[model samples]
Target: MVQLLNSYISLVIERVTMTDEQLVKECVSGSQSAQKKFYDLFAKKMMGVCLRYTNNYEEAQDVLQDGFIKVFNKLPDFESKGSLEGWVRRIMVNTALDAYRKAKKYQKDVDVDSVGFMLDSKDFIVESINADDLLKIIRAIPEGYRVVFNMFAIEGYSHKEIAEQLGVTESTSKSQYSRAKKMLRKILIEKNFVEESERGH
Candidate 1:
């Protein structure tokens, strides 16, 4: 993947206007220029998704490279029933999940009950924090909590979906998400992004 990206990076390819379908058709037909164009189109936005799941930028880049490789290899299977970008984003997310599973031994899971830390009925009003700061705060969370948090909260996956994807119980997913929110709330208060009093108990 690294070598593939390096070759793309070395090329001084000229940009051309092509719709997603057109790009995919050319790419599937083995156009090197078209492949580079496809890579350039979605790499930045997908990198943001990758960053949300990874511990640091380098790991995110690695995920991004691997994701693109999968995207190309699986391009023939794309049905075009959805937007191409959406399809690519799913590949990137799933690629990240694969990385998370491979590193599972380093993470510890807490079999938290459904009753643990019910922040669902409460409200939090975070103030004046930019996207970068928020992303940093999320990246600081422990691996188990962070992955579950991103999948459930940000990606809009249900606890059942998360549990199935991560090979855990639905309750485990819920508990991890609750803990992630609790930790995030604590960071917001400590960093003065939200006042402790503003949070509902």
Candidate 2:
């Protein structure tokens, strides 16, 4: 899978614009050219989504290739409940979660109370960190925190959905998410993103 996706990445190809329905129809018809074009059109943005759910670039690429394969197989089944990109992203996120579940060791034994250091005030302006920078930071967090945080905070999945998906209790999901937020705040402060009041008072 990795080799296949790597080869796809190495090709110097430009993506062409096509209507979603037309592209989907061509891809579903098993047109190699259309499939390659579909991959080009969505891979970059979808890879970013994959990165947020994985720890590193290689794993992100793994999830990306896996997700794209699913998208191709499932294209004909899509009911257009939402935008094509959004549907693709939903699949990518679920595929990343599957990758996480396979690891089966994301449960952390950390002391969330001690680990939760501080909070960032509104003036902290975390927007200074762009998407890639933020993904790197989030990926550095513990696995449980990363999963819960990405699902609840970024993807806007409810605690119930997260608990069900991750095979944990809702409270566990909520606590891990809270801890993730606190940890993020601590990191941002250390990077000098704290408000003036947080600096000394």
TM-score per candidate, in order? 0.81, 0.83
Which candidate comes out best when scored by TM-score? 2
Backbone clash pairs for candidate 2 read none
Residue lDDT tens for model 2, 1-201: 999887776653323445788788889999999998889889999988888888788999999999998999899998766799988988999999999989676685578676545543453246787776677777777888988888887787999999999888888887888788778776766666554346322
Could you tell me which 10 consecutive residues in candidate 1 have the lowest summed lDDT? 115-124
lDDT by residue for model 1 (143-193), tens: 889898889877879999998899888887877788888777777767877
Q: Which runs in model 2 stand beyond 4 Å of their true positions?
A: 1-17, 116-125, 196-201
lDDT (Cα atoms) of all candidates against the true structure: 0.81, 0.80
